[model samples]
Target: MKALVELANKAREVSGVRIYKRNVEAVLSAVLKSGDFWEIVDMSSLPVPAASGIVKVLIDEGILFIDDEENIKLTQKGFDFVRELGIETFEDHSCKACEGRGIPFYANIELYREFLQLTKDRPKAIRDYDQGSVTPETTISRVLFMDSRGDLRNKDIIVLGAEDDLTGLAIALTRKAKSVLVIDIDKRLIDFDNQIFKELGIDNARAMVWDLRNPLPEDILGNFDVFVSDPPETLPAFRAFIGRGIATLREEGGVGYFGLTLRDSSVFRWRDFQISLTSEFGVAITDIVQNFNHYITWDYHSETKAAELAPVKREPKTIWYKSAWYRIEALPGFKRWNEPISDDVFYLDEEGSTT
Candidate 1:
């Protein structure tokens, strides 16, 4: 009885795999459908206490045996026992966000070191901002604003992801835009923006709480003359936005001032991911800039340092650290062709690896 319970527990972990009473009618129904068999596990990986309990229970019940190869497999009687209980197995779950790619979160995780270094002595820089964080993309936006081409006396503009310097863009653009629409995920931050705009007499800007992860509403798409965002650097999040942003732009060929960071070591791998976006979506790369001296900072705790240190000058790193900025234009047939002469591409393809 103890062994029976233990076996049932394992099946429950896998989807479509469960232990239930076998009614003759249901058993017949199951027979017509696909079924999963047993799963193998490394005994060494399991906790000693749990493994001992399971092994003892199975051995006492005479349903498990170790073969000549020293691997455990269920016996005929064990299979029969499980079948009587209507036990089933199933395939592992795949992440819909990553499309079964295991490293869906790696891009953000790789930025962890940069975040640490940025906030090492300057905690306030991140905290002063609404999202309490400063990303490489935000820094890039600041850099672009310093080098923007056109006048903004009455331009129509939209700013997405008002977490860091993007918020500043919204506020700055509102001063000149005929109408400024700001979309952000945090309602509190949106409210804060509204209050600040009112206090500053920057009433041209309107704020709405929005999530970039969700599908952009039809009413909002293709409505802005200029769409701006410091989109998430993570690939899935980035992919989702590029397509949405391209659809949101006006056909007169509006500018999209977007920024993102590639890991110091994962530049080639990142370019590969970026190429996937351009191929999948019709976004063209305008200018790719590298900020080797400035690091992307975060604000999980303090903000003063984040705000102060952000503008202050910094020394460049010797190696192993970089903040890259990309200026992308939303246009049809945008292609970023990797140079065949690049040794990085050659090494990646030949070595069959990713950082």
Candidate 2:
């Protein structure tokens, strides 16, 4: 498929988004699986920007087209090409009960109801921070999952590095931990969490405004029993968030939770990333739940490259962003990093599109 590789390369240049021949193949297969633009976006397992770029290039090659109903369609030639490539769409076997997160915490009815009400006016995610909030159900599930995994329930200390979804708020509401500390670059989130803590007299919880790209504050370092974050998937960003989380651990056996996504990282990239987490930081990966954390589209999504590069002009009517949640435990003699990351490439990377 040298010809297809060249086409994906051409599309990459035109769109200034990253994609591989596999992405081109994925676009065509996504179209075959579903005709709707948004559904194809979800099916491709690639960000809208990269998927859009590949789809446009395929259309130019007469491999794909928009039907009269505005649905994505493959030409006869496209079908033959797919068959030659041995690409086939299959049924989704992920659990429908918990959306494949494997944790049905939503069944806990009361926590969902309480968290939904508390976060009704939390904060709108801003593009400036590359921010998007997870659903209230996801937040509650995260907390409950922690409890199930023996990380919560009177856990003396917990930390969240760079939070906007207010998982810290949900943790505080549970009253299961003695203290919860939230650190983020955004003062807006810190103020919101702090305000909620004060109003409810949640003395065990507090928020701080500190960019993790800089050195982590000394007092909190090596002081937490657990850490949770949903940082950007870029390597530097991961180190900035997860590395700081590691530094906060009081000792070995301290656990951490973070999110990674296929949209922004290839499985090969994930391999190297997991290597860094385990080797460089001396932590053991405990769990990786695919599509565990679902994200709501930001209001500014229309202003993103994903919208700009989409082959279709239709707006999305569904939440199409998700990430795998990772749980790591500090191994014996775990390394700690409190060093400043002066590099500015903390958020955006070639493989990362939606941000």
**lDDT of each residue in 223-243, candidate 1, tens digit only:** 766666654444544545555
In lDDT terms, how accurate is model 2? 0.81
Best by lDDT: 2
RMSD of each: 19.6, 2.4
lDDT on C-alpha atoms for all candidate structures:
0.43, 0.81
Q: In model 2, which regions exceed 4 Å deviation?
A: 1-22, 47-49, 68-70, 84-86
What lDDT is reached at residue 94 by model 1? 49
lDDT of 2 by residue, 1-355 (tens): 3477898898788667667788777777777778777678677777656777777878888888898777888889888888888888735789888888888867677878887887778779998888988877788788888988998877755555547878888888888897898888789889988998999999999998887788887898899889998878788888888888898999999999888888766666688888898889999998998888888878988887666666776777787788888999998999998788876767777667666
